[model samples]
Structures are given as structure tokens and as C-alpha cells.
Target: MSDLRDAAMSSKAWPFEEARRVLKRYQKQPPEKGYVLFQTGYGPSGLPHIGTFGEVARTTMVKRAFEVISDIPTKLISFSDDLDGMRKVPGNVPNAASLEEHLQKPLTAVPDPFGTHESFGHHNNAKLRSFLDTFGFEYEFISAKEFYESGQFDEILKRAVEKYDEIMAVMLKSLREERASTYSIFLPIHPETGRVLYVPMKNVDAENYTITFDDEEGKEWTIPVTGGNVKFQWKPDFGARWAALGVDFEMFGKDHSTNAPIYDQICRILGWRAPEHFTFELFLDENGQKISKTSGNGVSIDEWLTYASSESLAYFMYLKPKTAKRMHFDVIPKAVDEYHQQLRAYETQDTKARLNNPVFHIHGHNVPTSDMVVPFSMLLNMASVSSAEDKETLWGFIRRYASEASPENNPTLDDAVGFAVRYYHDFVKPAKTYRAPTDQEREALSDLATALSSEEAALAAIAAKNAKMGRDDPLPEADFSDPEFLQAIVFAIGKLKEFEPLRDWFTAIYEVLLGASQGPRFGGFIALYGVEETIALIESALAGEFTK
Candidate 1:
């Protein structure tokens, strides 16, 4: 434990680095609240997106890292601002027009478009919980509606009333001069109608913990700040929530980087210290646009899981998080293969190196060994060649190469086979462009065919000679299954033909055979797809079977 803690103290992994910062918070003394708290805020205006899932996933990494470094009890809050007014209806939901009548009302007060939950907010909150729950995140869900109405935030709301000028002074400095005139710290909800009232306060009665305001109908009313009567504007809410929860750590996107100071100052003004803040760059789509839940330009959690494992998605989230990433369907195969590579590497890594390994943090001491007998990219290429329409068809080829492997014994690999078939049909098959091999490539490919034929004849001769000699010279175990041996054969052939830098030879194989511009190692492909089958494929390509 001491050794692990020491390693975490100096580890360069971002999670560990953030955990070290959290540890510094309590270095001088234990927390006043008796436990360190990590909070992630969610606005349930729309279904939870990948970026939302990322916050919980990434924060869990830091929290897990902190657990390794300290014995302090830790808590993570997945807080939802479900009480926030519906500023605009989301464009993607079913029956979008039905929500038009309810704009400006609290999300919890709006009718659900999906007809699943009590309100739109509940529907989305349920989704966010199910999304996090599906990935096995440990967190407590807190609804802003419940938090305020249940009087959990009563004291803080009153405090905001008492410190109105100090908090507003800090807030007004950030807003434009024209907008500052009408802005108030407290936004009240109508007593009769459910819509949130955005009018400026006529007068604030700090002693009574209430505010006087005029409704849109020009009616005067003063409401107590307690029992969900009022909620802070977003900027003030940020700091107030931090103060109320004593959140030790929270992470937000770089967009919020500018407003972090306002949150901190409000937290301090409300008589609580600010939490540690982590600013991660936003995720971008294929077109390099920031991923927005409303725009729907990026891949969703469901779309990613369609082609890869949840662990692979988590691995993608674990990578270079401070930098923006393109979360598209095309990146899934690479993520799946690389995640397994890291898992395999973790098996032999030392304690220091293991601490630095993502899998160590992903699975801790319970890392599962990868059951993938074939790489994912290879499976993708195999799917392309075989035109596999189902997992059963792909399994036939898989069993041919690995006679011992079955879906029962290799569930992970079996899943990849299914994903391969689907991904090929969806993305690869449609995009495949089979260009004819150039003159040089044709000559090289013909030479490859001649080389394989000669090699086969020579092997047959050796076997016959061995039989005549009465020597049982069995080949090495899993000889055909070895990727390196098969790759060596192809590499030797490429060198003999002298394909110049040699990538052109490989490219010829991919374009002429797989219809892809890139592919798995051809030697590895030959090993799994069978040497005779590959030889036949080469002949067919040379015969213009593909280009025709």
C-alpha cells in the first residue's frame, strides 16, 4: 500500500496528477466534513451525451487514484440541475412541437416528449442514471428540484440572499453593461403557473430570506427563498452548489474555464471554501466541431457501444483527456485493439509500470486477461473478404483458423466478430473502392503467386521425404497460427520482388484484395485467413476478379 501510494504520488498519469492535487487539499489536516466529496453537474435539458458520460468516467479515475493515495472516505455526487428552466426545446426528441407550450418552465414541470417518465427532466435524468449505471459508475444522484424543495439548500439560498450584493457584484462584472441592469442573483418560479420567472427583483428582503419581484403579467409578489420558490442563475448556482456540497473536486469543459473564478468566489462568499477544479478540453466531432447534445453532430454512447465494448469506450475516454478527440465510428476498431494491447501489457508490467498503465486504473488488481485470439482489425479485414453477414459466418472462419476457439470460450472475441460484420456492412463495405493493381503491383503479385506455389511444392516434397525417412518430424505447435512466421514468409517474398519501401506491396494487397487503402498485417491476415485461401485471392486479383 505504501509503495502504491508513493508511485501514485509521482505518477504522470492525469488522473494521478489530479488525485495528487486533491491530496494536497487535506495535507495540513483532515477535511472538516469527515470525507472528501467529488461532484459532477448535469443539466437534464437533453439526453446525456458522450461528454456527460466522460465527466463521470474521468472523475471516477481521479477518485480511484485518490483512494489509492489516502484512506479518507470519498463520495461522488452526480448532481442534475433538473430544476433549471427549459430555455429551448431540444430538436431531436419525439413530438418536439408538444414541448413548445412549456418553454421557460422548469424541466421537471414540462411534459415528457417520450412519455416515459413524469417530465422531460425526469426522462433525461433517468437516462443519465441508466447511462452511468450501465457503465458501473458509483455515484449518488441529486436532483436540484429535490435538493431545493426538500430544504437541503435552504441555508445556502438564505446566505445568497444575505450576500446578494457581494455575489451580484462579482457576477455583474462578467456580464455586459446592458445585460447587467436586469440581471438578479435570484430567479423566482411563479406560484400559479409553473414557468420560471426571469424578472429582476424589485427588492431583496435578506432578513426574511425572500425577494420581491413582478411577474410577466405585471403582478407584484414576494416569495420565500426556501421550498423551491427561487433558484440561482447558472453562474451563481455553480458556486453555491460547490459551497453547499463542500465538493472537494469537480471537472468541467474548457468553456467553463472563464467562469470558474465566479463559482469559487461565490462559494467563499457563502462561507465555504471552493473545490478543486479540472478543466478538460471539449470533445470534437469528425468535422472538428465541439460536440453538443443539442446539435447531435457527434456519436452517442449507444452508437459507440454498437461497435465496441464498454471497456473500449472507457479506454478511449482515458486517453489524453486534456486534448480534444474525434469520437466517431471509424475510431472504434483501433480503440478496441489498443485497449487489449494495454491489457496484455499490464500482465507483465512491474509495479511502477503497472501504476502508469491505464488498465491498472481501469480494472485495478482484477484485470481480466484478453480472450481475443485474432486482432479486431484483422477481423474487420476478414469480414470484408468473406462478406460476412452474421457472426455465425465469421465464426466459421474463426474456428477454421483457431480450431480450439469457440464463442463459449472466447466471448470477447466473439463479440468482436459480430461487431466486425456489422461495422463492415455499415462503414467498410459501402466505402470500399477496389482499384486495379498498377503494372508494377501486377508483376509483384504474380511473383507472389509463383513464390507460394513453389513454397507449397517444396513443403510437399519435404513431407514426402520425411515419410520415406520414417522420421516423425512434426511441425511446431500452432505453427500456422503464428502471425510472425506467416509475416516472415510474405516479407521475404516482398524483399525478393523488391517492392521498394515495401509498403506499396502491402498497399497493393489491400487495394486489390480487401478494397481498403489500409489493413491488418498481411502476414497475420494470411495466417488466419489460410495460406491457400490467400494464394487463391492473389490469383483472382491478378485475374481481375475484383476490378471486374
Candidate 2:
């Protein structure tokens, strides 16, 4: 292992440390194929949403981390359960009546309600692939229907049929008494209607690998278990897929956690071990309700990409996957800003710190040195104040503030500028509120304006004089070259007595400038937006222009 990977493996930080643990476990019992297989599953019952993106992005992060510490080749399978039956028409999809007509039919057999692709399942699968491709995720896409029809799952299906009694015993142990008598591991497909029938199998001929079942019309038939003749229930299929694909690792949401033990037992019955599993909390909306694709209540992948970068979304997923997080439009700006911050930190931090940073994993250990001229939050403030409709206007301010920075040299910042503009228009504009500063706060603000006029004025000196500030650690000598110096100034300003709680003062400043009650850190905002422009904004607020 390289020194950097060695250091990364040593750190107890999230994914890298988790990856090391997984690698060590694999090392104890190496795969026969000499490679690790990571799987992220998608159910094709609905269009791909942000939750789908999160699973793939997070799994990719782990896979990338695994690649760094070990030479074991890794492959990620983006598997789609397209053969699943459509139990009900999704509330968000078009043509609900048409979808309802196909209830209980295989997703692949149902027509696309939107009239877009060959089948409903095909439409969803194509969408899933397109978005994953858009993010440049490296994974092999596999459809359950294709695997079943192509005989890839034949061996597993036969094994399941032969072990039907054992599988049923495992499945029945956890079910309620009322439902246990009727439950069967196999769900046969009716040849006449092409619908996946839920009726119990009347008889199973293990030697012939055949199951007999009656269709909806009471017509009885027997079919071979192999060659797409039957499909296993979800729990059994989960176990069978693990055995069939040799899945080394798979992560899923907590809702399916209860099924893990059952799947493990089923896999054991098949003479194979279950893959290393991770269960994560589900994504919730701002209202604390679960985010669902069918409900269409949460942000979509396309919506996020419209206002943020893929890296931002990836970073959002990287944080505390075990804890449920509210994912909505409101979370986008912070995620975008944090992604930029991580990139900036990656450029300056040491290898150990870089390993802990999200950008290091988000880029798969190839952490990019950022040329960010300004933070995203600051760009949003600029967008709000200037009402910049295009990149040219934003670049005009960027050029004036950071003479060395330009769209040509700082592509990431340039892209962020566009995102900030869109985010402001969509999310920030509607909720903006400007509260007039109190007399005491206005006087303090005027002092800040006077200090800005001096070419050599320091933020620390201004803060100390205005608020009687004291710190256990003595302030460093004023050096404009240090970014932390600007942060300190903003920190001190926030501590001023004029705005008693600091949040009020922060709100006052943001309200005066952007008509918003909260915004980017004031020091960074001033540095990127220019001292003169900010002074003018304060003056404009005092003059009552912003209130109008």
C-alpha cells in the first residue's frame, strides 16, 4: 500500500476506516474469483429519485475507499429489480388508469404510462442508467428481468425450488400465524396473462425442478423452475441474488433491515454466506415524513443537478449515512457550500486530514486542488444583491474582487456561480425578508463602513474596538493573505453587543444587503464582494432603499 493509503487506513474516519474493516474481513476468506463485488439495488417500480442517487453515490465512495487500501479489483453492480410486479400505480406517474389495469403484472410486461420507453420497467431502468451516467458513476448495470430471461438465474432458481421446504420454514418463522399458512417462496408467472401470480404452489417436484400452480381463472399448470418459468418472492430473491452474483457487499435502507436475517438464513440454506451488509436510515422530507418516489414529495436528481453539482449531492450522502436526514430544496445551498469548503480544505490540508475530508472520498482519492475564488454562499448573496441573471455579471464582480480569479482559470467557481444564481432565484427569492436595523445596530454598522474606507484597516481591530472583544488566544497580526483572518473578523462582528444574540446582527447584515435574514459569513462576503460594494449596501439599508 502507498503511504497515503496506509495513513488513510489508519484514520478512524468514516468510509476509509469502514473500507479497511471490510477489506480485512474479505482477506480472512478471500473470494474465489479474486475480486470484490459491491452491489446497489434499485426497484424499478418508480422513477429514480434522490434516494437512488444517494445509494449509488455512497456505495461508490466505499468502493473507491476499498480500492485505495487493497489491490483486490472491485466491481460495482447497479442492479435493477425490473421484474418486480406493479402492485399499484404510482401517484406521480402519468396515466394512472392504464397503470392500474396492469396491477399484479411484471414491471417489464406493463406498458410505460408516459408512453416513453418499451415498457414501464424499461422506462424506469433507462432513466436510472441515464442519471447514473450523467454523474459518471462507474458501474455495470444489470436488470433482474434480463438476468431471469437470459438464464443467468437458472441455477439459483433450481436451487430455490429444490430447497422450497427449507426456504418456507425460514420465511414462516417470522410471519404472523394468520398469514403463515398461505405464504410460499415461489411466485409463478401465469402463461396466459403474463402476470406474476401470488397463488400458493399446489405441488413441487424437486427432482424435475417443476412447480404447479393455478392461474386467476382456476386453470392449473406446471412449469420448470429454470429458464424464466418462475420468480422467487422478494426475500428469497434477495438471498438468491447474493449467491448468484457472489455479492461481496451490499448496503440498503433500514426498512429492509428486518429481512436481512431471513435472507441470511435462505442464503445459508443454499450453501452460501450472505454478503457483508449495511443498513442505513431512510431519507425524510422537511416535514419529517419519509421521502418516497411515488409521493413525489422530495427533491429529485434532476432538480438537484439543476441547482447544484453532483459532488454536492455526493457529499450530502457522505455525511452520517446511519442517521436519517431531511432532504429538500432548503438543504441544497448548505450542501453546495460545504462541498466547496471541502474542496478548499483538501487543497491545503495534509494527507491525514484530506482522508477525513469528503472531497477525498468523493473524488476517489484523487482530490482536486480547488481554484475557488469565492464560496457558494457568498455567490448566492451576490446573486441576491445584484440580481445577476447570467454568469457574465457574476464574473464581473469576481474579477473586480479577486483580480487573479476568472472563469477561465476557476471553472469550479464559475460553475458554482451559475448554481448559486439558480438557487437564489428558485429558493431564496421567495422567502427573503428584510428587517430594518435598530438605531444601536445602525450606528455600529456605520462604524464598520468608516473602517472599510481605510486601505490598511483590519477587521480584528475594528471588532475589538466596537465590542470590547477578548480571546484566550491572542489575535494574529493582521495579514490579508490569510483566509482565517477574514473569518475571525466576521466572528468578532457577530459577537458585537449591538446585536445582542449575534444571530440578530447576522440577520441584520444579511437583511440590509440581500433582503434575506441569513447569509454567508460577513467577512468572506466582504472580501469576495469587495469592501466598497458592501459599504454601499450598508448605506443603502440606512437610506431605506432595501426596505422598499
Candidate 3:
């Protein structure tokens, strides 16, 4: 049988598979060290949506896989095209209506709403960096404003301009075919205030990054610089930069696949390598519509961190092939706790069975189990129990608790600490949610408790009888001794005559065992936690309350 690692590396799933094939071809000959793994982001015209992170996260997965299989180093670059002028204000941002006059300026030049940064773009960029960092994602980030203004890409731009006609023709044809937008064969260049005409491309004179456009007839011209004079049109600028950077691979949304082929043509004209492509699908909202910031129908990444950890978010995004479906927060957060549990289990000696599977090794390492630390819920629980005012004490308790959860193989204490810190700093206490027990729930808990108690007593009695006969059987006594406690719990549960659906039994059991009315499942937990602790836990839960 093939090893799990071999099975996982056998193929890269779509839409990345196409790109991976190209990478594989290159791997046969291998690209240079520091092979580029690029993921691009548009200007922060508004808060970034989860779809934005989805693109980068999937690309990161591909990059990680490539590194593991081929032993080539990758620099996953995240480019923020902040030089792209703000096309429109996103709906949810306050005071968006008043920013129309500033639309054409580079995003870096725009005013900051939070007053912490010089401009709105910088502020949002900071938030994005923080968000990605929290998720433990690593990348080399470049801002377009800095790239253009610092002249790091000057030579590339000159080459692009030298092949201006060829690049323009390619882009124009692509726009017509794909976007259906007509172009006038004129590149918009800044004109002097008194200039009545524009300079033709070849004749335009540029001095110290400033350029003046003169008409074909040499009648009128305009001088423009970063703030004033010149602007590269959308699709063309993207092509020129890719050519400059020598990018080996880049991923884009499915919507861009049409124009993307055209950009490759521009790369050919500019005498630079075009990146291999991976086209990901768009994320849809709960309503099943494409999430759009401009349309005012999207959830931001920040909004999602409230309910789940970043690892869960990343795991959820790539659990299936990236192109298979659209994702939303509601679905992702629901599975995170269980995912965390699985990760913890895999770390233990008992985990050899579970972690040995091929599916667990897909794309990247099964989220390091030893690193599966306590979540916000566990951290809060520890804090509630701690006597010291020290943050480290809370963190220490979390690490210990998480270690106990996976006794055989555990993630490092550092990972536990890191997760705990992020949870404490980033999460808000959830609003009080009390689900009243239903009659059905009462009867189920009561009946199960009663049956469990009877079984326990019967086993104990059998053990006692065997002991009197000098049989000394160890099994029955080992399994059951506290029949009375089980009966008490069942009776207590039976008192609440309400209709609780079978589906919600887990929550009811959690409530009963943990006092918060929810901790883990009842039956499975009872099996693992043992009947003695289960009874103690239940009695403590029913009487005092589950604190930690």
C-alpha cells in the first residue's frame, strides 16, 4: 500500500491542478531558488471579505505542497494593488458618500477614517496584515504605491512602454472579447492645464519620471507624474508588473481567467515570464449570491474571527478542492471545534490510526496536532479558574488542559500559548444563549440515566455474588459501582418535561455534564471520562455548576 504522504502528493486538486501541472513541468527542470508564489489583492476600497483570504489561503496550500514534494523554496508574495484608484466606495463604510472627489487618487493618498494611518488604504492594509498574522500565514507583502513610487519597477515599466503598441493591442483585443468594453486606441496621459491636445505615445518625452503627451500632429501635450501625470490602465498594469517581478505562479478568481490569457500575451511582448495560473471560484453568501463589497452583500474577514479560530477557517477553506464550492462563515465555524478535537486526537499515541490516513495528509500537513492548543472557550474557562492576575497563568492553564486533551502526542506549549493569546486579545464574550430544555429532552436524559443506573447496579450485584463464590471476576466491578448517582441524574433530568428534539441531545448532555449545559457529547464523553467522573461531573453540574 502507498504511504499517506505519497497519496497526498500524488496530485494537486483543481483548479490548482492545471497550474500544478505547469509547475510539475518546471520541476522536471526546476526553477531557480526563491521561486515566486504570488497571490494578489485589490485596493482596500472597503473591508476585505473572506473571499479575498480564500484566494491567498488556497494558493498557500499549493505552495506548501510544492515545497514538500519538490524541496524547492517558495516566497508566497501578497501584492496589494493600492496604486489602483478607488473605483467606487463600498456601501458599509461610514462617510463613503463624501469621498467621491478623491476617487481617482491612488489609494495611499486617500484620507484615513480611523486617523491612525495617513490614508484609508494603509489602515486597511494594517488590519489585513494583523488578520493574516493571527492565522499564522506567512507571505512577502508589497504595496503597489510603494513599488511605483520607489521606482523599483521603473525598468519594467520602460520595457512595457517600449512595447506599448503590442501590449495595448493585446489588452484591447482581450477587453473586447472578454469584458465587451471598447477601447479608443488612446492611452490616457496627463495633459498640461493649457494644453489643448495630447501627445502621441512614441513622441512623448519623460524627464525624471514625469511625462508629457503630444498629439500625433505635435499640436498639444501634457506632463504627468505619479500624482499628476500618468496612469497605467487596469489590465495592462497587471501584466507589466507580473513581467517585472518574474513571478513563477499566481492565482486568480475564476472571473479573471478570460482576461488572464490576454495578460500572458502582454508578458510575451514585454520579454518576461508569465506566471502559471490557478483560478479559484468565488465565495457566495448564505443567500447563495456572490459576495460583493460594492454591492453591499459580503461578510468581512474580521467578522468571521468572532466565532472561530483562524486555523479552523484555513482548514475549512481548503478541506475540499478549492474549486469545488463556495464557502460561508456559518458553515465553517460549525465544524471547527470538531476539527480541533480531531487534531488533538491525532497528536496522541492513540492517534496513530487516525493520522495514518491519506485524506489527513492532503495539500499540507494535518494541522500539527501538538500545536492544537486550547481555543477561546478553554482559555476563558482557565481564566475563570485562575487565582492570579497574571496573563501567563491563564496561558499556562490552557496549555496544560490542551496537553491533557491529547495525552499521547501533543502540540508544543508555545502553540497553545499562541492560540490562547490570540483568542484572548481578539475574541469578545458571546452573548448569553440559553436553550430551554424540551419535554422530549427531559424524558431522554431521564430514561437513559435510569437504564444506565439499573445496568450499573445489576453488574455490581453480579460482581458481588461472584466474589462470594470466590470467583473474583474483575470486569464487572471495574465497569460499574455507582448505580445510585446515575439514577439521581436521570431523575433530575426527567423533572424538566419539555420537548427537546433528538438532534439537540448533544447540547442537552453537554449542559447536564458541564453545568453550562454543553461541553462534549453525553454517551461518548461518559465512555471516555468514566462513570465515576461522569457521575461526579453530573452531580457537580446539577448542584454547583461547571466552572472549568
The model with the greatest lDDT is 1
Give per-residue CA lDDT, model 1, range 1-548, as digits (tens).
Answer: 89888888889988899998999999999998999999999988887888999999899999999999899999999999999999998987999999999999999999999998899999999998997898888899999999999999999999999999999999999999999989998889999897898889899998898899899999999999999999999999999999899999999999999999999999999998898999998999999999887767788887888888989988888999889898778889999999999989988988889888888777766789999988999999999998988998778878988899999999999999988998999999999988888887887677666545554633443344455557677532334456665665565556555677888889878899889999999878987788778889988888888877
Best by TM-score: 1
| Order by lDDT, highest first | 1, 2, 3
The order of the candidates by TM-score, greatest first, is: 1, 2, 3
Question: TM-score: which is higher, 1 or 2?
Answer: 1
TM-score of each predicted structure versus truth: 0.94, 0.91, 0.66
Candidate 2 local Cα displacement, residue 403, angstroms: 1.8
Candidate 3, residues 283-375, lDDT tens digits: the string is: 777677888856656456765565455666666666554454555543543446555665666555332343332224332454454344444
TM-score, candidate 2, is 0.91
Worst 10 residues of 1 by lDDT: 457-466
In the range 1-548, model 2's lDDT, one tens digit per residue, is: 48887787787667776687678767667778778989999998888898998889988988888888887899999999888888888898888887778998899999998899999999999999999998889999999888998999988888887888888989989889877877788888777788888887899998999998877788899998777768888888888888898887889999999889998888878867788787889999989999887788889988989988888899999999999999899888889778877887777888788878888778865667777767777888888888888888888878877888877888888888888888888888888777678887787677667656653455545447454755445545675434466555555555654466767777777776678767876777776677678789888888888677
Q: List the residue pairs that clash in candidate 2.
A: none
lDDT value, residue 169 of candidate 2: 89
The lDDT per prediction is 0.87, 0.82, 0.55
lDDT of 1 at 517: 91
Once fitted onto the true fold, the runs of candidate 1 whose alpha carbons sit more than 4 angstroms away are: 454-481
